[model samples]
Structure formats: structure tokens, C-alpha cells
Target: MPVGFWVFPWDIEDEGIDRFAARLDELGVTSASPSVLYHSGRALLPRAREHKVRLLGGPGANYPFESLETPLAGMESASAPGTGKRFWQGLAEARSDRGIRLNAWAMPMHGSELGRRLSVAVVRNCFGNPYSYALCPSHPQARRFAESLVGELARSRIFHAIQLESVGYLGYRHFHHHEAEYVGHGPLEELFLSLCFCDACMAGARREGISVVELRESISRDLERRWRDDVWSVGVEDVREALAANDDLQAFISYRQATVASLVSSLAELCHSESTELHCFSAIFPPTLEHSTWIEGTDFAAWSRVLDRLIVFGYTAGGPGAAKVDEGWTRSELEYAGRYFDPSRVNVVLNLAPQYLATLDDARRRFRTISEMGFNDLSITNYGMTSETRLDWVPELGRVLDAPASST
Candidate 1:
């Protein structure tokens, strides 16, 4: 298997590029996917070198690109201040010296700064409340920002591939710190709440022959009823039933898928033109058309035509007892992805945290399972957050993953 380590700019800066590259080499890592465009956050220590918390911004950007020179109207630049080593330059140097492939990891639409500043461009719930953390992908300005960002990254020419994250509409639920909102929200409710009915999205739906007005009213009525605790058990099946019954709802869903596909296709073109391959990191699992389309606006079939590879999160560590369940989930995801994209290009990212995997044995088992599934590419969730002891598993896991396939 081709093993890649997911790293952050600060991780490289603190450890020093040479040392970091050497360590990865020792661990038998074949590639490095470093974050180039990322959201605001601080890295936890013990696992990370002593470094100050990064107050949410793209830290690696130093040189001015014409695409990002002029700020989008009503939005602030989320680029972190260039105070120390330039990320792209350092990464390029390390790649040259260490001979490891670099894949630029970027988050296109998940900038909280842009969403907070341009509330109108953010995703809105059925109650017309804006999620000021996720930029609505259908927003014209948001799409332009994403395209320009991708173009600039491709032009940088430092990456073997560009991995995009959060390139679709974000749902209501998130892993935000200190989140305390408890509204008895179920999966179906979260799905309903995630649907963006912003002006751009509504207009797009209308263009796709959807009755936006009727759709909006229907959603509003359902939300109102749910808010009052009047509905009993709203689940994925309920959402499916609604889609089956309502033409407008179905059209709106189709429009969402098309919106995301169009953006990805445009980015793919820019990347290809610049001689950079495009990859996507999506949370939409099982790779089913309906689940991917309705939940996250991802169309795997459409993406397969453009993306060089697709990496899906297979962190299935609910607890020690959930190993079998995790394996089943991971298998299903890889199997589904193989239906659209080649198995060689479908990578599964595993979580190495103790909470996700209790022991090294568990990690070894999971790694072997992924290899047995015929996936040639494997990645770990993160390097910055993994402990020193846990880091030891990389080389061992690499050995297991790199082993030749067994004869039946």
C-alpha cells in the first residue's frame, strides 16, 4: 500500500522540515499530505511540539496570488499572518531533499472567517437562520473563492495532488468545541436542518425545475412541527419517504448534487490544466448515490470522472467491542468506492488515536483488513495529534500494508 501521513504546517515548522521528513522516512511513509488551506484551530500538545495555538487561518500562504489579492465582497481573508517559515517553500524543499511526494490538503468552503463575515453567503436552515461557520457552496462568491483558491494551489506546483475537504454544503451538526446545543436532533432532523435554502441555492433549485416556493413551505411546516415535538421518530427512512413522495424535494436534492459536482468539475479543470491531480476528502461514506447526494451533495460518479483519487474516512472506533462493526463499515465504503473509481485510487484514512483504536493490535488488524479489501492506498488521520508511542505503529502498519497479497 502507498502510505501517506497527514500533517500540518506547524508540525513541520516545529519539528524542522529535515527532521520531520527523516522521521516520516523512518516510518516508511511514501507521501505527505500537508494542510495548505485550513480552518482556525490550535494543536493539542504531548503529541505535538510546544507551539502556540493557531487562531484559525491558512498559515502557509505567504506570496500574493492575484486570485486572492482582492478580498471577496463582505468577506475577510482567512489567510494566517506570515510570521515564520513559508509552508509551501519549506514543504517543497523537504520533498526535494527527502524524495517524498506531497499532496496539498486544502479546505475550500469551510472557512469560518468567510462565513462569519458574509452571513448572506452562509448556509441557512429552514427557519432562515444562517450557519455562520459553513459557506454555502451555491453562493456565487463562495464558488468563485473556491475556484480561485484551487487555481492558485495548482499554480504553486509543489504538490503531486490537491486534496479538497469540506467542498460541499456543511450540515447543522459539527465537531465544534464546547458545543452545547441539545435539541433532540435525530439524523433525519440534522439532514433537514442541513439543507441550505439560501437565495443562491433556491435559485439553483428553481433552475432545475423545482418549485422553490412550495419546497420552502413544506420544509418550514415540517420544521415547525418538529420544533413543537409533534412528530414521532424522524429518521433516514422518513427523509427517503418524503423524497419519494415530493417531486420538488427530489429536484432540490438533485440540484444540490449538481451544484457540488459543477464546482468540483471546475476545480478539476484548473488543477489538470496546471498539471496537478485532484483528490477529495469526503465524509459521505458507503459512496451510495442517495446517501452522498442528499446528505452532503457529493456525486461519486460525477467526481470519478474528474478526481484522480477519493479518500474516505474509515475511523470506526466506537469502542473496543465495535471492531467487527468498524471492519464492516470500512469494507462497505471501499467496496462502494471501487464501483465508481479504481480500487488503487480509493484510499481509506484510519484514525490512530487511542480513543479510536484501543491498541496497536487493533491498528494492525484494521490495517490488514484495509489491505485485504484490495485498497492500495492508505492514510492515517493525523500526525500532529498522535502520541510518540502511537507513532511507532506507522512503520509496523506500513510493513503489514506493504506485504504482498496472499494467494487464495
Candidate 2:
């Protein structure tokens, strides 16, 4: 695997460009992706190039929930993506000279904390109201909004690929506390319920004569009456089977996948017209593991057939169980991911920050395992930590990423 770092650390803003380059050079890193701040600073572009590191497009640090597929000026309100066309143009030219590729990563799911703080809705939870800023695949407006955003980004010369991450709604159904009586009413009640009983949504369902309203009402009543009963204890098995048995729901998911595919495909066609590359980032939910029922509907495997590359964030494998039981947990996860997609077109993001950096020995083990996975490209969680802080292994982790994999 070509190991890489997600270099947008919160602390790097004040650190001078020279200091930053020296740090990467010391770590033996060949390339790094710029953060939103990096793009704004013209001085850092040449410095990164001089260091001979490939720089992917930085993520726009604006409202996370703003549909990248929408036409709202609100989506462009973020600083860099808002007025960074000139920055992108500069980046494109610089990358051409330096041989780096620019890829824009956008979060289409829940909006940023800023969006939540401002939204009137009270969809409260640990991760914020799931409704306020998430892009519900069931909504046409949400889909169109995403499509338009892609079109706008496609016009840029600097960004060659687009990384759509965390695009789907809340995962891990167990975490969805309000699913019982809430039905479609989440924190973003207006947006979430905006089209729940909408004419278009209802009409489409009516075409199948499925009566979505009746089904929803039925479930809502059941949930409300048994709200106190342990749905998990009572319904988990049935819910799982219900999710599996509904071929019709699965078909609906396929249709939604086709809708997303069409939007991305259209954007790709737009990019190809300009001779730019378009790609999508997705994750493979381990079959044995529990995932949100909605994920099966996202139909990403079908999506891979149409998009350029599928970047699987294989962090789940490096999770709690393996870490506690086996030192080689990360490697096993990467290998498992390889089974789903061709290695050449897949980019597995290695978790090298925060969670992985719990201890130096565990960190070293994670790195070694990732290296052996033979991934085409690699990325860390983020560049938020400093050498003095929680990251005692930054130098070692960086060295591991920069070094050639033993197998390679």
C-alpha cells in the first residue's frame, strides 16, 4: 500500500510552511494533502512541491451538512470552497508542475457542529441531530443538491477527483434511539420530514401501491405503544430478518443507488468532458458485523462498477476486538477489504492517528500490519496532533508510511 497522511491538523495553521515541510521531510513522507488552510496559503504550495510530496485537494471546512450536490449559495459559504476557485486554479497548475493529484473530499451526511448550533431543530444525540444536516437518499431535493454541487466542483481544474465520504445517513441501527416512534422525525425534523409524506415521495410509493404512510404509521404506533419495551431485546431479530426479507426494500435501495449512480455518473461525464478524473469514496460494511439497515440500500458494490475508484476506510477491522485479542488486527481488516474490491482500484485509509496512537507498541503494530496489506494508497485519520502531545509515535508512524512495504 502507498501509505499517506491526512495532514489537516487543527494545530498546523500557525506553524510556518518551512516548519511543516521540515516535519514531513523528517518523517520521510513523500506527499501530503493540504487542508483548507493550506490551499489559501500560496507560500506553502511551492514548499510542499519542493519537498516532493503529492498533495490531494483539501476538504472545505464549512458546514458539513451543506449538500455538496445542491445549488445553495449556503453550500459555498465555507471559506476555501467558497472562494477557492483561484486557489484551485493555482493548485492545479502547481500540481501539474509537481505531478500531484487534487481530490476534493466532502461530507454529505450530517452537517458540521456549526450547522447544528444554528438549526432550530432539536434532533439531539451524541453526534448531533441526525436529521438537521444529513443527506437523506430518499429525498429528491437532497439528491439534486448533491448533483449540482458535484457539477460546480467538476468545473474546477485543480480537483481531479471527488471523495464523497460519510454520505449515507446514521449507521449502526442500535444507535438510532428515536427510530421507534419517531419514524421520519429526527433532529432535522423539517428536513427529515420535509418529504416523508411529500407528494412526490408518496406518489412514487403509491405507484407501487405500497402505502408508505400506512406502513410508517403502523411502525410508529407499534413503536410508540411499546416505546418502553426493549426494542433491541424484542425486535432486533425480527428487524434483522425484516431488513433481509424485504426484497422490495432492497429493490428500492437499488433504485436509490441507481439515482446516486446517475448523479455521480453525470458528474463524471462532466469531468470527463473536461478530461478530469471523478471518483467516489465508500466503505464495505463487514457482513458479519451489524450495520444500519439503510446501508444495504446504499448499494455501494453496484456503485463501484460505475465510479473510478472505491476508497474503503478499513478502520473497523482495527477496532476493539482485534486490538484486544490480536496485535495483527489492522492487517486482517485490510486483507478482508481486499476480498471485496480489486486491489489496484481500491485505496485503503490506514488509521494512524488518535485511536491507533494509543500506545507506541500498538501504533507500531498497526503500521506494520497496514504496510503488509499492499494497499494502492493510504491516508491517516487526520493531522491534528503534535509531536509533544498524544502522538509519541508521529515520527515512527511517518517513517513507516514513507518506507516501502516489505512485500512491495
Candidate 3:
């Protein structure tokens, strides 16, 4: 079993790598995935040497590659640690001595600053309004940029694995800063609005013989009905079921998945050349969890063969009031994903947040359930974000998952 934590460079550098690795070693953590690149986010660190509770990462990879003439739109690599030692070098040091496997976490297209700065065609809604946070893979510039960055990371040969995240289409409702919405839509509405009809996506769909005009009209009508009537109109609760009633919708979705898969296939080929395992985050538009990656253009049928591992989210915690999550939710989601993905090539990410796994007992029970599911590869939600008390559950989690585990 491989047990690890998803952490940022600041997470390790905040307290210094030696101290951070010592903590992980004490908790029996086998792997540490430090973000080589990421999008924007605010984090709360429990063991910070400074600003224990402060703004965290943003878009860009700031280390010393000197690849670009000017820095990315944000603070040049997602709030890099302004410490004496560089994160990559310290990470290598920690890995060499602490036996911690370094997973290079990179967000390919999910960057608010970089996307806006580079003027890449991001995912646009049926109305043609850009989401700004996501770059469409169909765009040549976006594809080339992602390929160059990821290829560089793989060639570095410092990481045990290259964990690719947000390598596919992203959706609306990303919980942006002070984000607001009136629709309060469920799966269908969110899915329709999240569909990208940008020029790049449009041209690709047309080449695939998909009718963008008809699809747009279909989505418009559905949204109009949903907005005014407060119903899905088709009375279908599940996204798969709803999409089944429409051939164009299904075909467009398939095209999106194929585009994403093709990009990953290229990246995987590059990683293979460098002897680095390529793992992708099977995520996007949650409440759908494992089943919903399709909405964001990631599909096991398309990516499983090419990817070294597909990471799926199954949260038992952090759900809306008690009404959303139940005892069987995580198991059901994992079961659905297991039906499609090879267990040997899957890593299930569970929450370590206190709201979900409050105590050592909760961590123990969750670990046992996941272990029984035959998912030997597992990752906890994060390191810096979880509270001090909640992080104490790590030791118990390690005791339960001491065999093997990893994260990014």
C-alpha cells in the first residue's frame, strides 16, 4: 500500500523540508507530492514558521528553469517559498535521505493568471463566455505550452512520478473567490453550461462531424427550461442517463474525452521516455466524483491504458450539510470507478479534513474500508490545509496503511 499526502512546496518549506519530512516519516508516510506547478488557492498551514494562516499558491512554476522571458501572471510560480533553499533542491534532498518518493504535481491547463495572460482560448459556455480559469486543449498554443512544461519536468529525472492534474476540460462552479451564482443548478445544468464551444473546441467538434449549432440550440433550450421551470425537463436524475437521450450530446462528450486523452497519450509517451510514471487526476465537477470525470472530459475507457495511474476522489467529508453525504457514498463512488478502472492503476483520494475524518477512529475506519476495497494506492487530501488536530490522525492512518501509499 502506498500512502501519501498532497502538499504544496510552501507546505514543506514553511517548516523546512527536514522538519516536514521528519513529520511524514514519523507518521509513516511513504511519499510526498510537492506541486511543481499549480493554479490559485488560499491555504491554512498548521505548522508554518511564518504566516501560519495566510494566502498560499497561485498560478505559475517559479523555480529556476528560466524557460520564459517574463514570469506567469501571478507571483511567478504560485506563491513560491521565499526561503534560502529552493523547493526542488530541498525536495530532492528529502527524497534521497528520507525515502520519500517525489511526485511532481503539475496543473496543465487550470491556471487563471497564465490563461488570461497568454490569451489562450479557455472553456467557454454555450453563451460563449469564457470561464478564464481553464484553457481548452483543442487550442494549439495551449497544447504546445502544456507539452513543453510537462516534458521539461519529466526530463528533470528528480521525481518518482509526474502527477498531471487538470489536464482535461474544467467546468463552472470552481468555487472562485467570493463566487456567486443564482442558478444553483444540479448536474445537468452545470454540465450544459460547462461545455466548451470556443473556436478551438468548435472546430474540433465540427471535424468530428458534430453539429455545434444544433448542440448549442439543445443546450440553450435545456438551460432556458431549467432556469424558468426549475426542472431538468427530461426527468433524468443522472448525467449518463440524461445524456443517453441525446445523441449529439453524447458524441460531443466523446469528442471532448478523446481530445483530452490524445494529449495525455502524448504526455505519457514523453514520461515513458524519461522513466517516470505518469499519473492523472480523474477529477472535475464533484458530487459526481468518480462518475463525473466524463463531464470534464476525462474517461477511464480513453485514458486508463495510457496513464500509469488515474486518481479518483471519493470524499466521506466536506460535503454540504448532512443531507449530501451518507455512510455508503464513498463506497458507491469507488465501486462505480472500480468497475471501469484497473485497481492496479487507480489511486483513491480521501479527505483528511477534520469536518469529515474528525478523529483517529474516523481515519482508522476510512482506511480499513478503502483497504478492503483492494485499492492499495491511496492519497490523503492535503498536508498544509488540514488543521493541526486533524493531522494527528496521520499516525493512525499510517498504521492502517503502512504497506504502500502515495499522493500528488
**Number of the predicted model whose TM-score against the real structure is largest:** 1
RMSD to native, candidate 1: 3.1
Off by over 4 Å in 3: 56-58, 68-75, 83-86, 230-241, 285-290, 316-327, 402-408
Q: Which ten residues in a row have the lowest lDDT in candidate 3?
A: 66-75
Clashing residue pairs for model 1 = 40-56
64-172: candidate 3 lDDT, tens digit per residue? 4444433342335536767423567777887779888988888878878766766656778898888888888888778877787777778878888888778888887
Task: Rank candidates, TM-score, best first.
Answer: 1, 3, 2
Off by over 4 Å in 1: 52-66, 72-87, 175-177, 230-235, 284-293, 320-322, 405-408
Tens digit of lDDT per residue, candidate 2, span 1-408? 244455542223334434554554555444455442122121222223232233322233532233342233333333333333444454455445544455666544334332243233212222232444434544556555455555556565456666665444333331222345443322212111222333433445557655466644544444444435533323245445644765544444444355455556665676677666655555323322333223423445555556676665545544455444333434554565455556677666655433444566666666566555655466654544333443335566656655777632
In candidate 2, where is summed lDDT lowest over 10 consecutive residues?
Answer: 37-46
lDDT of 1 by residue, 1-408 (tens): 588888876667678778888999898888888776666565664555455444554322422345663454323224332443365677688887878898888776776666655667888877788887778889988888788878877888878888887788888764444567545666666667778999999888878778887888888888778778855444567667777988887777778888999999999999999999999876533322223534778888888988888888776547766666677777776777778888888878887887678888888888888888888798886887788899888988888887775721
| TM-score, per-candidate, Cα-based | 0.90, 0.66, 0.90
C-alpha-based local distance difference test score of model 2: 0.46
